[model samples]
Target: MSTASDYLSRLISFDSVSRNSNEPVSDCVAAWLQELNFEVERTTYVDPRGVRKCNLLARRDPIAAQEQTLASGTGGLAYFCHTDTVTADRWTGPGGNPFHAVFENGRIYGRGACDMKGSLAAMLDAAQSISLADQMRPLWIVCTADEEVGFEGAQYLVDHSAAFRDLASLDPVSIIGEPTRLSVIHAHKGIVGMRIRSQGKAAHSSTDMGINANVAMVPMLQTLLEIDEQCRTDETLRNDAFDPPTLTWNFGVSDEMKTVNIVPDHCTAWASMRTMPGVDGREIVERVRRRAEELGLSFDLYSGGDPMHTDRDAPFVKELCELAEPYIGANEPHAVCYATDGCVLGELNRRIVCGPGGIAQAHTSDEFIEIEQLENGVRFYQDAIRHWCC
Candidate 1:
């Protein structure tokens, strides 16, 4: 039997970064499930970059697939995890390779250790430890690709895959294994990523003939800042459940001219907004566009994920909290500030975010998961399986 730690080490070695193909890691997971007598369906799709990404959906019993009817009572349980991790170029461990898992000081250090191949390993171990014959409902494990880059793999599964269609039809109680330090998460902010481009005529800096796109962006940026301030001060957008209790915006990236002597003809700025549950992300985008237009600049809203909030009093959530409380100590269903693939999956079924490690450790130079936490995560998943599937 492979322990969670053993499975984590193998998963970490895959280097399944978001910009790269997740086929290798997905293949490993599929094979492992197959070995457990699961009927695996590999859904392959070509990403926008023409890279082939694979999403794996596995069920323990093959006959379950033919059962067209959804489970009526105590429906199936599905564990969802993303196979891709963000890029890590500055690893601080001994091997200096982000893909190489290193155990040190009671922690497993790797790129995806915290957010969240750790949870993936725990789910695998817990599933394998349980006897399928005792399960009252089908157990499904889904591994999606490109979660780090706008959840493209999840989007593909929801839009195109037949396996996901069947699972959605069943209305399974779902768990999205994002690292929450084993606490239950019922609410989280959404993200809206936008790219605004300012175009102007290029000329020598010494001459006033150039429109200077960089200069043109100043008023537009100020407009965004004002809008952000309004969002921060608005009580309507506040959700007291979340920390800070208001929408947050950041202008993180900019593309502009390289040389000092040339007046920039084109300038692009990338910004993201984190919105509360009831806030309208599309309205926010339109507001930004309106502001840009008023400032005489061209703008485009590119990508975003919706805010997610499962009722804390939901039966499944309460059951999960009860099941996880023993291992995690007073498991409270709280809200997080960051986004998850749950933003998409929550639309399909009743879902919660619960797993090992902390968001603080995710995507850091020294990403790691505490050994004890990893073990407890396995226990949590096992308890969930017993509660929901048995």
Candidate 2:
């Protein structure tokens, strides 16, 4: 019988960096669920070399035996949590290894410990504590891979599953257990991360035959600045739930093609757009594309994670609010600028992002989750199951 803290520590110890396969952690979760009498489903996504990465789903039905008593109209709930964390970089410190789980000063320090795996542990602990014989609706626990790189695992699950075909009729509600500091999040902005490449002929610096990629980037930067301003000032697009009303854009990565004496032949800039709820992401991309064409630049754009929202007054939201009351004090429904796996699940059911740790602690150096919060999360999940699923 592993406690939530014990499970979280074990989970954090596995080096499931987003760039690396999460097979180790995913396999451990599969085995644990199988031991709990769940019928586990493992969906594998193979790399070119034939190495397999996976997303695990476990299903349990208390109503299976009570079929005559429960009837066909009974519905269920789904829980989603990610199994990957970002790559530990220079910011993670000299001695920092994101895979190492250290418990000190009432907190557990590690990479995924706070960003997500903590919530996964809490969900598992809660499920194990409750007796399936008393539950009314079925329970689906899904541990998805590749959430950090992109939500590929979740996308595969939703696109390839017949179980999710009639999701609205089956599990009408979904809880994506992100680190929300116990708040119930009903809405969040969308994001599209893309790269734009600029090409020019190479020439000696003395000969002005080559175009400087850095110089070519000026107009694109200016256009993005204009778009950012519009995102800030648009009244209808603004929402108070987020700190700054509208969306924001930033150039996250950039690289110039060459050395000091050579005029570079090409330059590439990677940019990301955080779109507001009412704004159309495709429209924004098109506007950028138009600007790039006018500037005689060739660009490549990739888009994903569209804006999503669930009704604030839905039964699931209400249930979450009631459960979070004692711990977080009358939780207020709100929106966030950061994106989560909820966008995909939103298409299936009414999805809400809620959990124990604060987003501030996520993806930070010496990242840690308070032990008290982890304990509270276990109880919160247990109560949610008892009140709603049972």
Candidate 3:
């Protein structure tokens, strides 16, 4: 197999930030996979901001290995990854370059190196290592866009990509390479978002003509605070398996009119909350909606898909634990505090989150993946491919 670091360097060079179109990165990956005899399909969607995003679904089948492959391969293995990273606006990598990949002190430094591009490199290299003729089942790879902003690309793929639906019919064992430091992740939290806004007439400071939209936002903000407190106090929503053990809230606010001389004609407040597995995220959504209706403020609510969870004792989970733990010196699968494409691709019921690098380095100004993790991730994926596909 080609070295993962080499592949990573090339991938890191493509600045596929979530806010920008991922065409360059997506096109590159699609071409690379196609060159390796994988049948690749490209799908696209327009983001809410009107940016054109892409998703690549690539597959390899050994017609000579099994008659099932000649027809519809009902069981195989699938690897999931995203092509986008958070903004590189705060990039502080070597020489103030985020797209220029660098190897320093036993780590690879670049934007998306740890967050996900490194994982993508490993997956491709591992898949390349296995010969098509030696594999009895199909191998599928899914690369989606906009994972950092939201799972918008994944959601679009799930809904529109016929190739994605075709692969899903195979009941493939799923692996989400989301920087778990190679420790198998059995579950993680889900995200919920709400946006509230008010509009009023703008005017001069001395004028009574101004309707003062800020006045309406006050009641909505207060209600959100009360709900946040409610979530913090709700023991039923707690999950001790995860750190912090409860749902957490993040609030963002802005007003159109910046000067104090005039009443703000437009005010917007948005909130993000993470929902634990087995917790009802809709409860919060419902409460926020009722408050908006009461206050007559326009509001929007979106669930970023359900929390992902696979039974700890499931056969696939056990096999993954046995295969991946020694490299990390860990014994069992664990839970994380973040969501992945698994939340959106739930139809592939057998899923695990395991990959190189730690989540702590993800999306940071100075992002990097330990060399050890990157190399081991390559071996882990190779082992998994041989065991599950070959």
Candidate with top lDDT is: 3
Candidate 1 lDDT score relative to the true structure:
0.84
Per-model lDDT: 0.84, 0.78, 0.87
By lDDT, the candidates rank as: 3, 1, 2
Comparing 2 with 3 on lDDT, the higher-scoring candidate is 3
Off by more than 4 A, model 2 = 46-52, 63-71, 91-96, 166-169, 207-211
Lowest summed lDDT over 10 consecutive residues: which window, candidate 3?
Answer: 65-74
166, model 2: CA deviation in Å?
5.7
Give the Cα error of residue 25 in candidate 3, in Å: 1.0
Candidate 3 residue runs with Cα over 4 Å from true position: 69-73
**Poorest 10 consecutive residues by lDDT, candidate 1:** 62-71
In terms of TM-score, which candidate is strongest?
A: 3
Model 2 Cα lDDT, one tens digit per residue, 24-84: 9998999999987778887788644555678887877785455742466555667889898
Q: Model 2 scores what on Cα lDDT? A: 0.78
Question: How far in Å is the alpha carbon of 360 misplaced in model 1?
Answer: 1.5
> Which of candidates 1 and 3 reaches a greater TM-score?
3
